[model samples]
Structure formats: structure tokens, C-alpha cells
Target: MIGLCLGLAGVVWAQLPVSSFTLAWDHTVEKIRWEEDYRLTETGLVLEEARVRGNGAGMEIPEDARLEKGSWHYRRPIPPLQPLSLGRTPQAGDYQLCVEGDCHALSHWVGAPDINEPAIQLWTCTRGGDAQ
Candidate 1:
């Protein structure tokens, strides 16, 4: 019983590291618009910020959305955000930002579809600098 409890504690502690999530529009001129960062906690995932770039603007997440079973739940109604499904899937180079120790790629369809917005593509946590 004690051993089982210890193992469970270790698992919980391992999840303490903060992970970032970003939503950016694929544009021809600017490339990216808004990028958001989220941190994981014992209670749930928290939104750190939603950064808008160079004359670009977007709707902000009303509150911190908890990550439940790999899905995010916001407190209030949010704007649309999801991947484009014009039939042909995008290649890695089309939307992937690669760097040392980290890579930001378009997020797969995870979580509820009804609330997912189609205008913004997801980005993984980056190590250093902007997505190139």
C-alpha cells in the first residue's frame, strides 16, 4: 500500500512542468498573428498570455481552461479555433517550426469539435526565438 502511494505521488510530481500552447493564423504576409502560452498546474492548465503580433488582433481566452483528459474547457464562450480541412492535409514544412529540443507544429484534432475554432492553427512549446 505504501509503495503504491509513493509511485502515484511520483507520477503527479512528474506532471508539474509547465507546457505552452499557441494559436496562430497562417498568413501570407505576417505568417503568425496571436500566440498563447499555457502552464500546467495541480488544479488545471492556466493561460499565461495571448500575444498579438504586428497590427494583428484576435479574441482572448476569457479565463484559464483546465486540461481534462487532454481537452481544454474554458469558463465562458470563446471564439472559433481549429485546423483547416480543405481536403488535402498540410505538410510539415507548411506549418511546422523546428528548433533545437523543441518543435512547434499544427495540433491534431484533439478535444471537443464543437468548440474548436478553424481559423487558428496550434503550436507546441518553443525553446528559443520565434518560429522560423
Candidate 2:
């Protein structure tokens, strides 16, 4: 099955069995909620949608953004990403990766981040006997 590979540094540590997932987190500076939906494709990871609950510094609402259910939603026409990087910090809290209707902390896949390794990398991968 196609899923996501979670890695630290350059080594893959864990693989999640999900074709699509929603990543939700609170802005470090704004303390507002932000969510992004992504789907795994043969080419790479495709960003499907993005939403922000109350914008602040660095969270600019796009001209095409629509306010719905107290959040600004919009989509960007960007090419597929080979790998996606996310910053990790205790102060910012854990990143919630939701698949289907369930959500889990990203640490659940790869464990806590080391002080020296403050970032997590996610990419499309196929899972069988091993993640590739």
C-alpha cells in the first residue's frame, strides 16, 4: 500500500499506512490553528487543501481564501513535493496527523525528536516487506 515515510536526518524511521492525511498544528507565533491535507501520488505528495483558524503573523489569507466555519480555506497550485519537512518543538506542541477520522501525534510514528534533530521529513512511500 502507498503511505508516508517519516524520517529524521536522512534515514527513514517509520512508515504510516495511509493514502491521505491531514496535518494540523498551532502556529508557533500566532497560536492559531493551521491544517493541511495531503495525498500520496505516484509522483510525490500532493497538497490538496489548507485552512487556518484566525490568521496572524506570517499567516496571510490568500485573495481567494474563503472564510468558512471560522477558518480561512484556500488552495495553491503547486507541483508535487518529493519530501515535506516540518519543524518540531515542545513549545509548539506535537503535530497531529489525521487519517480517516482518527488523529495521532506525529511522535507516535518516529518517537520524540532529538535536540540536534529538530525536523521531521515526510514523503510518499510504498509499504510491503519494507518501506520504499
Candidate 3:
């Protein structure tokens, strides 16, 4: 009975709508390329870009900095996932870590169109003059 209860709880938690989600892509050459969060709402999508400042050999982007004004757009919404891997790539692409909800990481893009939507389409960044 305890095992069944835990399984049901897991299922409920998985179904709960995620308040917000983040996606990060680390580029050593650029120190930071793409690291941002997208919040879901009844209206639409809200995008917040990471504001990083140099801190010795490391970096720091404060929570206040993340609260800086971000843009919002309307797009086809996707279901919330609990640390799920959205997509995968065979070889290393421009991004080191392509993350989604709850630290779900995707390394490469095999060109599979499973999670390819307008929301992900607009949430892109340019590195060294090249679009990723």
C-alpha cells in the first residue's frame, strides 16, 4: 500500500503544471552564451535573459539581474514536464548544455521535430556572430 501511494504521488506531481522553466547553453569560448528562463502564463510566454557579470575567473548573475525587464510573446504552449529530456543531438552542437525544466539537459540536435515549436524557435541566441 505504501508503494502504491508513492507511485500515485509521483504521477500527481508529474501532472502538476510547472510555474516556470529554464534553458541554458554554456559556451566556454564566450563564457556565457544562452542562459535564460521562460515562464508560462495564461496570457503567453515570458522570456528572461541572464545578465552575467565578471567575477574573477568565475561569473555571477544575481536574482535581481534576472528580474530585469524581459519580453513576452504569444505562441503555442507546451505541457509542463518534470525534469524531462526534451530533445537530443548525436554530435556536439554550438551549445554545451541545452537544458529545460528541472535541469533536463540535451546536448545535440539530431533534427528530430518532437519539441520543435514556436516557443523554442524564438528562444535562441547568437554566438560570435553565428546564430545557434
Candidate 4:
């Protein structure tokens, strides 16, 4: 079975039995909400869609983005990534990983990161392989 793996420093920390999830966070500079939906595949993770409440600084809404309610929605046609890297910092707050309809802080799954650590890696892995 395919699942999502959370790791740090090349070591797998947690394997979630989920095929799809949403990663949400606040823009560090803009202080606006941003969310990305992703699904796990045999080869890697696929980003389905992305939404941002407001754009500023480095967060610019795509020209094809449509205004839906109070947010801008768009789809990025990027190829599946083997491993997705996420930056972590106390100042930016924790990332909310939403599965099904429930959302939880990423730290809840892998514990808090060390100050020296800079990023958390996410990718798809087979249950019997690198994932436990």
C-alpha cells in the first residue's frame, strides 16, 4: 500500500496511512493563509490544487486563478515529486496536515523539530519498504 512518509535528516519519522492530504500554513512574510492539496501515488506525491486567501510579497496569484469566495484557487501542473521539502520555523507556525476532514499540526505526527533542523521532507513510500 502507498502512504505518506514524514521524515527529517533522511530518516523516516512517521508513516501515515493516508492517500490524500492538505498542507496548510501562513505565509511567513505576507501572513496570509495558503493551502495545497496532494495525493500519494506509486511514484511520488501529486499536487492537486492550491488556494491562497490573499497574495503579497512572494505570494502572487496566478493569472489563471479564479476568485472563489475570499480566496484565489488554481492548479499547478507540475510533475509528481519524489520528495516534497517543507521549511519549518517557529516564527512561521506549524503546518496543518488535513486528511479527510480533520486537520492536525504536523508536529503532532513527528514531534517538534530541533532548532538546528531546517526542513521536513514528505514523500510517498510503500508500506513494506522504507515505511513501517
What tens-digit string does per-residue lDDT give for candidate 1 at 1-132? 000000011121111112433333354444544344443332333455444433333443344655454434454333322111211133212233222335444333222222223222222112331111
- lDDT (Cα, 0-100) at 119 in candidate 3: 15
lDDT, candidates in the order shown: 0.30, 0.83, 0.32, 0.87
TM-score per candidate, in order? 0.30, 0.91, 0.32, 0.93
Clashes of 2: 0
Ranking by lDDT: 4, 2, 3, 1
Looking at candidate 3, what is the lDDT of residue 89? Answer: 33
Q: Choose the strongest candidate by lDDT.
A: 4
Model 3 C-alpha lDDT versus the unseen true structure: 0.32
For model 3, how does the per-residue alpha-carbon lDDT over 31-130 read when each residue is reduced to its tens digit? 5444555554433335544433232234444434423244222222354322223332323233322234345433233222233321112221122211
Position 92, candidate 1: lDDT: 13
The model with the greater TM-score, 1 or 2, is 2
lDDT of 2 by residue, 1-132 (tens): 787888855467888778899999888888899999999887788999999998679998999999999999999999988788888866667898999869888888777656666888888877741234
Give candidate 2's TM-score: 0.91
Range of the 10 consecutive residues with the lowest summed lDDT in candidate 2: 123-132
Taking every candidate in turn, the Cα RMSD to the unseen true structure, in Å, is 14.7, 1.9, 14.6, 1.8
